[model samples]
Target chain A: MRNRLVVQLVDFDLAAEYRRLCELDGAVGAVVTFCGLVRDCEQQAPIDSLTLQHYPGMTEASLGDIVASADRRWPLHGITIIHRVGELLPRDQIVFVGVASGHRAAAFQAADYLMDYLKTRAMFWKNVAHGGERQWVDCKDSDRQAAHRWSQDPKRQ
Target chain B: MIKLLFFGRLGDATYAAPEVFEASVGLTAAGVRDALSSLYPALGRALFEPQVLVSVDRVIVDWQQPLLDGCELAFLPPVTGG
Candidate 1:
């Protein structure tokens, strides 16, 4: 099985996750992954940190739904999904999506698709600590645009 | 009646959740926006031409939503996540 999904409140062990993903090998020749880091900049505000929160039971279900969507959309051999909730500082990893496939194309595209959808369609939001103050933020227009492009009937192959 | 709620800057300017007198009209989102613009003049300055969008039921919605009675509408700004 090449699918692994995790939605945890604790800090994820990156090394263990990397190991579990590589344990199975079939059609996978390459595994590509991306981990998003909380940065100090958010639309020009000097962000101190962020507390990402979600509707617990529903968030995992949604992550599973998204990973399944990617599997149907791309031919893949292995997949790993991890997301972080609770407070995080700058440079702290917030999310990770990795995919393994027969070739680089599947891995690359699926990773991108997962993130694009996660940024927009996912029901996670943040209580952002910016410039000594905190507030909530909605999904970015770029993320929406990225999601809109995902439905391009031609790219699913 | 439904509330077209706002948060952050939108909330601060209006100082409360701005209400539309015809919120009970079962209006389309676009229509609700127009109602707010007319009823709360400040909403016209703050939200009439916003750099942001709205989300309903935790998902990005189009200008049209088949809102039934008692649907809590949430107005949101663009999200920035790591």
Candidate 2:
């Protein structure tokens, strides 16, 4: 699979990443992308800033594993994953996941699967700056459920 | 000797990143945990928590996985990334 996995402290160009995948192969028919941003509010409180931490070596390796899992389930021609670390503010882009495939269904499903897997599998932590303090964000039950769905679905298996 | 690394909240708790431990062959990750707990009670409590995870050479592994002499073990908190 043609895949790009990047973990950096720099911002990414979403359009450029998507365009690059589209250019990689003429057979590409569909491209699906997801960009995660730091939201302004959490639990009704205004978040002042955000910081992302990661286990550097494991972060890239784990992301590659997630992309590989998506490739196993879908006919993806290309995939791009970029996650940013360091201090960030509300509305800042935190992540990007894109998939290119010969059909729309594969592109969509693979992108969705990559996001779900990355949320749980990748070794990154998020800390929110709120009310003169910073605290680590707790893992949401919904994310675990979302990632688990891929394992339980016989069609994907 | 083996390198025991900590990341995320676990790193904050220990106030250390990669702590080292002298080990013999066939020592399991659980044994290392036991040693750490004995050496640093705070780390012991934090590590024994249900959410804490262990990785051998950067890949997540069970606590029962045996530690090699020069392996790097990492303690990871629950992930919160997208």
Candidate 3:
């Protein structure tokens, strides 16, 4: 089905990933992609770098479940999710989510849904280096709220 | 034996390598947590926190979940990745 779910220590090519989604099916008229980059500052402090840690087997499995949930919600032609691990400097790409569908609304919503779930459901943990100190990033209540909204959608139920 | 793993801040707090623990009969996830807490007090406190989660063989489970021999047990802190 041309779905790509990956967690790696290397960066990914957004163009290449988008092209793969386009080629998944001739009916795919829309492809939406979301790329996440490390911010340069955290809490007004200039960040030096970020390190991501993840559980090996569980991380991949969790990604699969997220994709599956998205597929169940929308009519998606293809999906691509790539998350980078290990040390990353500011502005470095940390994650990519792409969705292709027969129409724009499905593609857009699915991509949004994928990203929301990935932020909260995926197993990767982010640790930031800033102001000569290192601290693990805490899960934001907003991220949890974003994920919760999807479940609260009456259409899904 | 159950293999134990810690991630994120929990990993840093414990500075632990993946360790094997002998699982006695009818060992529950809570039992393992209590046992490990005595060994690593910092980890104990973290695990008792509201956000920490326990996974058995890579699947999130409740504290009452039973452990089987050769299973992997992991304590996950609140995840923050995009």
- Residue ranges of candidate 3 with Cα displaced over 4 Å: A155-157, B13-18
Judge candidate 1 against the unseen true structure and give its global Cα lDDT, from 0 to 1: 0.70
Worst 10 residues of 3 chain A by lDDT: A148-157
| Chain B TM-score of every predicted model | 0.70, 0.88, 0.89
Ranking by DockQ: 3, 2, 1
Worst 10 residues of 1 chain B by lDDT: B13-22
| DockQ class, candidate 2 | medium
TM-score of 3: 0.94
Each prediction's RMSD over C-alphas, in Å, is 4.7, 1.9, 1.7
| Ordered list by lDDT, greatest first | 3, 2, 1
**lDDT tens digits, residue span A102-141, model 2:** 9999998888888888888898998888989888888899
Return the lDDT, model 2, position A68: 79
Identify the leading candidate in terms of TM-score: 3
- Name the runs in model 2 displaced over 4 angstroms: B13-18
| Of 2 and 3, the candidate ranking higher by TM-score | 3
**Per-residue lDDT of A69-100 in model 1, one digit per residue for the tens?**
99898878778888888888988888988888
- What's the lDDT for candidate 2? 0.88
